[model samples]
Target: MDKKGYNTKGRGGGNVNEGGDGDKWSRWWWGLSHRKSAPSEESSNSNQVQRSPSQSKSPKQKIRISSRSDKLPFYYQNWFLVLLTLMSLSCFAFALFVFLYLYPDSIESSPSSTSPASSEVVEITYGTVLKLMHEKTKFRLHSHEVPYGSGSGQQSVTGFPDVEDSNSYWIIRPQPGTSAKQGDPIKSGTIIKLQHMRTRRWLHSHWFSSPISGNQEVSCFGGDSESDTGDLWRLLIEGSGNIWRKDQRIRLQHADTGVYLHSHNKKYSRIAGGQQEVCGVQDKRAENIWLAAEGVYLPVNGSE
Candidate 1:
């Protein structure tokens, strides 16, 4: 039962009398600030302040500190809401973790199944070329897929190789367009009949190889360089047709291939259209103005 009292053992003590003229708060203020003509704390205060690098707070102090936020009503401070929110988030995280652990694959992904997949087909056609570059390169030919109409009264024929005398070469077979490979065994009724006149060109760098219809240009004696054939050579040949689609180009990958012609007896020229024809040493000797094409009026004898 030690109540707060004054100490007067030294001259450094305060002059607080037992019967002071004030209440507790005033007394405390007087004790801290008021004094006779004594020196200030700057000159005489000698109590050393003991501090540890780290302090272990007492249980009472800890309880007092923790009670500050806890004792307040929900409207008094924001910390209660913050703590509640953190606790709710922790609980939700724990629930999510447990759910994922129990059913890993069942968790709905951020990109739901309703989202579009990467495997959708996108159609792209530019200028004269209607190219469809896709992961799946091959397309199965169907009679409906063939670009033919109920009219044109056209029929399919064989012996394209026999006419060319080179099975290694045939023409770019129409519809179900394919790369340089064996022709697929299409249905018998399937044939390519066009209402518009079909045309193609053979692309050669050195000389006029041939074209599906028009005359071909050659590097004069047809060398790989333009110097071998000058620009002064359009009048030497003939050019017909007002509109020849540049997209309608042919690749003379080899000499063995020949184009399929329909029932038309008119003579037509052909040439390489795509790549600049590059010639090597042996190509110089082959004057056989790279046969572009041989026209036909009948399918049976169309090979040139």
Candidate 2:
């Protein structure tokens, strides 16, 4: 047992020594062993430091992965652009529909939309002076001056303005209202009769043959002062003259007969002198075109 204890003490490098020289050798050996163990511990710490970064980097990589997943998908990324494009298209469609629906009539009535030959027509009013002219010879419509005492007399249209005949001016009186008092508005579709401003006679035509033009019927000024079918005439605006622009032509059609008021190249006798006798014909001619303008104001009565 004593020898075993001696060996254990010797392992400490002369731990059995009791003198100064022995203690010195023991301390030196112990110092050498401690120094060798310290280097190994330092190597282990350096390894731990290097492994720490790799261990912590796993969570950091996970954080980066999660952050990337949090972003919206590529398909949904441009949601704002998609919504804006849809809204813009919808607004444009709505505006286009509104424009087309609101102005349909305007588009149809536009001059560019209508046929080249067709034109817009308008209305003609009362108190219009119509100058009946020959298609070949332009002449003013005239009536014969009544004798000193005559109820009604023969009438003819003349182009000669040599004498300013008041008979040339005829007042359009709508038969619906009072002869000279309550007058109705004269329009393209209105049924009217003309009265001689001076003779105070309404233009009347019968089945009688014209003395001058044996082929056509004669038109004379004679009818009831109130109203008569023979006196009623239908007024129409020529081709495109219904718009009532200045110098528009008018047409007079006999109500009793389908003939139009026409003057020929023939010369006829009249109270005013030699004038063109107005006749009624079935065919339309250039002479049938008549100009209308505001004429003398003939009062319905003394107070009117």
Candidate 3:
């Protein structure tokens, strides 16, 4: 109603709300200057670095482990293997050293190149004096001047308590000597017949029970022929078949029966005038001990 389309103040529409218009134009110029003065935010963001999801958080650094062998160069890998081998060899050497140090005595005492000769058994030869001393009473084997046998063949064998008695001396010889002479030591395993020096008969045993010994094996004088193995005697010295050591005990094995010569107890009241009864036994006992001596055969003049 009051000139609705036309403004008449200086310029076009300059009269209508000049204060508001002036304010609006000032705000617009200020915004435009601010934008021109500062750099664009989008352009700044593009220039700055931007991390991807995979590369964030320090890129997840890989863990690393190193050992002494790993520090070596690629060319020295074989040398690392050689070093391990050397260490294994050193362990073996140390083990061997411990073994020798712990068992020194065992190594020395073992049956080696060197040993004492005294430990070995000595072989006995023929013609050596053999003294068989009794292990208990020190008695000896002896023969008396008694006579027994049929018509022309008779002999005597006796046991004595006193070794000093002349009849107590017996010689080990291959054959009986007719004259009085010292007998030589017979070799071991020599099958021989023991002859009584007084009666010149071999020591013999038979199936007949001993009259004086009460049903024991009868020990009598053997004839000159010695046809049977019963008259044969063998001296065993500690299983070696050789002369034993001094005071060493022995066993006299009979060739016929393989029994050992044994002595009975003195309690046998009738021991034929206090004479010790000698019999055959399997094992060696105190009574079997006899002090053997090297003596001459003093043959009785009328014994033959």
- Residue 116 of candidate 2: its Cα lDDT? 26
Candidate 3 lDDT by residue in tens digits, 4-81: 855545455455466867987999999998897677665666555454433554444321234554687865878788
Ranking the candidates on TM-score from highest down gives 2, 3, 1
Candidates 1 and 3 compared by TM-score, better number: 3
Candidate 2 deviant stretches above 4 angstroms: 1-124, 128-136, 146-160, 177-185, 223-226, 241-246, 269-273, 297-304
Q: Candidate 1: what lDDT?
A: 0.27
Give the winner by lDDT. Answer: 2
Taking the tens digit of each residue's C-alpha lDDT, what string does model 2 give over 1-304? 2655535355546455468557778899899999999999998998899989999999999999998877868548788988899999999999989999998776665433322222423223355443343445655676655331222224543454432345666666666554433323344645777776666677776565555665455444654445467788887776663333324567778888877777766775445355665667788877676764324322222333
Q: How many Å off is the CA of 233 in candidate 3?
A: 1.1
List the pairs of residues colliding in candidate 2: 134-287, 135-286, 135-287, 140-159, 142-157
- Deviation in angstroms for 101 in model 3? 74
**Model 1 alpha-carbon drift over 4 Å, by segment:** 1-76, 107-304
Backbone clashes under 3 angstroms, per model: 25, 5, 2
State the lDDT of candidate 1 residue by residue for 1-304, as single tens digits.
Answer: 1256546333545455455435656878777666642445534443222222124346657888898869997656787888889999999999999988997755343222312233532111111112111111111100111111222212211112112121112122223242212222212223221111122211112222222222232211111221211211110001332221121211121221222211111222222112121221222122112221222111111222
Candidate 3 deviant stretches above 4 angstroms: 1-134, 145-156, 175-187, 211-218, 223-227, 239-241, 244-247, 267-271, 294-304
Quote the RMSD, in angstroms, for model 3: 19.3
Ranked candidates (lDDT, high to low): 2, 3, 1
Lowest lDDT block of 10, candidate 1: 139-148
- On TM-score, the leading prediction is 2
